[model samples]
Target chain A: MNAGQQTTRRLVSRTGPSICRSCLDTLSRQPYSTAAAAAIQTEPQEALPITPPTPSPSYALHAGILVSRPPLLTRPPHPFESAYHLYQKRLNERLALPFTRYFYIKKNTPGDLEWKRKIKQRLTPARDIGRYRGYGDEAWNDEVLVGAQESEMAWQVERLLEDAERDGGEEEGKKGEGVQTVGGPKKLEREPVERPMPRVTEADEKGDVRSLGRLLQRSLYLVVKNKEGEWVFPQDRLIGKESLHNAAERVLVQSGGYNMNTWVVGNVPVGHYQHDFVPEHLAKSANPTELGLKTFFMKVRIMAGQADLKSNKLGLTDFKWLAKEEVQKTVDEKYWRSIKNMLAER
Target chain B: MALRELPSRAASAVLHNSRPAVLALRPSGRRNASSEALRDVESSSSFEVPFVSDSLVKAFDPIERSKRRRLGKKPLPPSRYQFRPPKYYRGPLHPHQPPPSSDPVSREFIPGPFASPRLEQTYQSTIASDLMTLTYHHLPPGYRAPVQLQRLREWTGDSPYFKGRPLRPPRGGGGLRLLDPPRNFKNIPEITKVVVHSMVPEAQDNSAHLHVAGMIVQAITNVRAVTHKARHNVVGWGLREGKYVSVTADVEREDTFHFLSKLIDVVLPRIKEWKGVAGTTGDSSGNITFGLTPDVVAMFPEIEVNYDSYPPKMIPGCHITIQTTATNDRDARFLLQSVGLPFYGKLVD
Candidate 1:
């Protein structure tokens, strides 16, 4: 027997008889063997011609290296997808749609009162008798040829009488509440009766209450009277290759007659309104697009100038510097609903 | 005083005072008084003393006495006043006195030395002829030579790509070979677009905050941003379908180049404790996506200007995806390196 087999037999006898000799012999030989001993054992084993066991298919090799191939290279779908395609899709969807450009003209409080007076005088011709005609030849010509008509003179006389009657009624009301009407010394001795004051209108309250003295009170949105006399905000068709805000500024300068240098415009739109393009007449002149017009409104603050808008020069007859309440009442329901939040009182 | 002359002076003073009273008795005094007053008033008013003083009137003595002591001194000559121009006045006093020059004087034209050396016409013509002949000979056989080149000597220029050196095609039939260093990589590869995206949790989705995020993106990129909605619902993550969970702004062309320059020159340097973008940050495609902290996003000058509008607590972190027109990550990395963005780590296979 070999040395390993003899040692295995000794170990097996020491431990127990039933233990397998081959397992013991293999463990002992593998642990104690050096490179030289391993070489010697391999030579002898080769000489004896004991065949080696075959490897499993899982551990198969070809050409002394692993036989597995790399997965076939493929392109991912994402990198080929581009933002330009998405942009084109969005553009196609919005084709043939009309866009509205909205601009707000800032108002000067003091100038607004003068503008309102001028508007009132223009509206009521009969009450503007003392209005300045002109100077020199103009005044002479106006005096001679454009004298007040009989109807206007009669209306003026009627207005004077109405004014006198109102003054007289106010005096009578004051006198009725006075001690003279009661005709008693006791009434004079007693504390003055707390007279119920007249209920003030919104205009009266605005005149009485002082604002916080902020330089800017409210911004004025440019509005033009349409042919039907309905008040509509100044709007222009958005041109190609122009942003909505830029288009609004251009429209304000060209049509609204606002100086571009004096106004400070915000970049982002404050609000937007979308309405169907349904004109009253189905004439060819009217727009016949199926899509609605989407209007983007941006806020602009006036930096300088009197904020006097020249409406007549741009084919608009009249304009008014309206407050939030007046704007709501003047604009259409759909427009008011979209812009009310932007014009809401802070 | 001479006694007699003094008596005569007193007598003359009395006579001078009495004469004016005596004259008042006649109509001449009244006429002269009215006329003198009118002339004097007009004269005085026309030449009014700007600074009037009572002391000046008391100080003046107009009449001379005939006494010996007074006779030595001649009577002060009547003070004459005439208006003259200010002492410092250098030109005409009246506005219309000096008329504007009718003729505008032309400024002399002093031409500076020629900025560059003037080469001889012969030299330029020779070079031009040589260039024409060179190009003509090098032209493909099917193309006809121009008439100017027919008069020049035959000359064929070397290939522009190889300069004067002999043409050396890439070596080893299928192996790689280095070529001349390109001045610009624009033809081979380029940045296609820069996309800025930020995801908001479903529970944290607020339209106002999202709007502010969109505004920030717009401010940073100078391009309008669009809201991205969730495509699929993940019930476990509380995500719902069609819900807005992120915003993105895709910048291209000039804006993409501008953003890249700003990221390299400004934003990246401001990031604290930053190493570099990892080499493995890109996918199989050449698009690279990297996460940025909220503070790092705020470092962009556009957002810094209007930072108050978006409070710090509301500023969310975002991911920036840089897409390049390259086939693979290695090429994309080379492109980014050319633009000054450093990459870290050895690239994984």
Candidate 2:
């Protein structure tokens, strides 16, 4: 074996078995159930129809149509398979929103409608499936998340089913003296306990939310402070990349919209190291009140081209904030106690 | 814009590389008479008044160069348009038929818009050359220079708030009562009036350290006057002669606040006629002097002056010092002068 392999083996041998405790527990319980579960997910394997069913007369004119079925996209092989591939390629190109000139769909067939109704019936309680979904995967990937995998027809049916279930649950709870929490239970705590959970939306998978979130994060709210105090606004922070998606649903709303934003000016970026004397000098030279209130601004050019943005490229100019409330909160007693013991060792 | 008007006087001055002191003495006005007529204004060599010709002024624009290129021939009399010196003076209009003016400044420089007869009539009395010079230098100062402009915001919005509370009264009272109080200096008077001055190296090459040392000597000596005035009005006796002193550390950077504090404490009590400086207006030189006793400097370990060093030294004292490595002497001069320094015999007045 290679030296690296030998070293890894030796380490494993010294540490005992390499199997994860949880994985081992899963394996010991039964491997068959997981396989059966995987096999039971039949929605993805079913090929789309040559033409999607047209909407029923009622749906066709429905002004409240929250969901609409797109036309069936086919990639079928043919006698002239190569030509068919080329045609498929052209059709795929037409699928692009920017270049597509027209789009039409045949809606509403009975069999498809039944499948939608069945999928809709399965959704309940809106449980967080983010951890199981995997990063960058849409919240509603067909094989990944059942709650998000339902078709448009199924979605409407699902909403009706959920309303019925909620009403039924409330009635049952009323019989049992009036208390039924949505996601199981909650514990009483003094300070509001904020649980960071990823929220998956049906629109995120095979829909526009993820892409739209990316555009907004890059263009507008590029610089932001996270829980770790790092100034970064990844699209992942908006739509989420990993299975832990829907940061906006959790932290953003919980934080009461007090999020700070930044803009670049001059050569000085925000958070660039500055001495106390800068304020004194500005107070003497520029407007003293601005200096005292920390309102001096600078404009600077980005040193790196925008192309390297995917590689964590930083511009020459940076925007730093000395946000008053945030800084005060940072030095507060409770916040200090939270990190003090461990930081003291460092 | 006309060729003659296209290049700013600053650019011409830069091209000519005239010394600032020399240029300060000259009076260069603008040109006059709109170029639309191509018929008005006389070109006379008799008086070297140097009013730019309407034709010569038309050629200097960068945008016009593209138009001249499209015409398949270079414009004649390129000297006025280019940065080079003119070999000869031509007539009022160039030999070639001048193209129509599409320049932005051409219309703006004149009183009225293009093709208007009133344009020439309105501006005929004033020379155009003077107006160009006026516009060039009249750019708003502070973060608006070509180099710094890119970084400035479109607008700073509003003026910063200033706290205009009356400055604290000078610590010691003036005249006899301040120096020898009715109860004989009962309350140790606070040294309030501090006079801060800066010292520069006689030569540009002098070490910043040595220069600051010299400045400290001067500031201390000058401060002595304020101190003497505070206590007993002893003319110049606050410092007993022959005690030479120097600061080991260079504090040229902190002189303003540091000296101000020192004046409030150390130098005030030693003055004989120690009345506070609140009601006092102009000193003999019309410049205010502040004094602090050495005791205050004793409170701060940063200062090196000794209160017990009774007799002040004969060594030349120091003032605040500024060090710069930039090419712009004007920027360097402005930088120091902005920090409350007296420049070109201009006082705070």
Per-model DockQ against the true two-chain complex: 0.01, 0.01
Writing each residue's lDDT as its tens digit, candidate 2 over B98-207 gives 22234212221111111112212212211121122122221111212222123212332354432443334434655211111111112211111233332222222333
For residue A91, model 2's alpha carbon misses the true position, in angstroms, by: 80
Q: Per-candidate TM vs. native?
A: 0.26, 0.15
Winner by TM-score? 1
Pairs that clash in candidate 1: none
The digit string of per-residue lDDT tens for model 1 on B1-349 reads 5986998999999998878666676754334532657664454553243764557555433322124446768867856974332334346655523223231111221111111111112112122222222222112223332233222223346656545554443445543322222222223545679999887653245676787677778778866689987788887877788888788999876567667778888999888778888878887567788888888888889778656657557676788999976556766676676466888887741
CAPRI-wise, candidate 1 is incorrect
Candidate 2: where is the Cα deviation over 4 Å? A1-222, A225-346, B1-306, B309-317, B329-349
Q: Report the interface RMSD that candidate 2 achieves against the true structure, in angstroms.
A: 39.7
The local lDDT score (0 to 100) that residue B53 gets in candidate 1 is 59
Q: What is the C-alpha lDDT of each candidate?
A: 0.49, 0.30
Model 1 CA lDDT for position A313 = 35
lDDT of 1 by residue, A1-346 (tens): 5675554444434443333333444444543344245445455434454446543212111000000111111111131122223222222222212211111112564334433444334222223233323333223222211122322323434544543233223333455665455544231122333443333335445642222112122334445564557666655556655665566566566544654233323343545667654455324433343335566665554334322346423355554445466667887887678767655331
Q: Candidate 2, what DockQ? A: 0.01
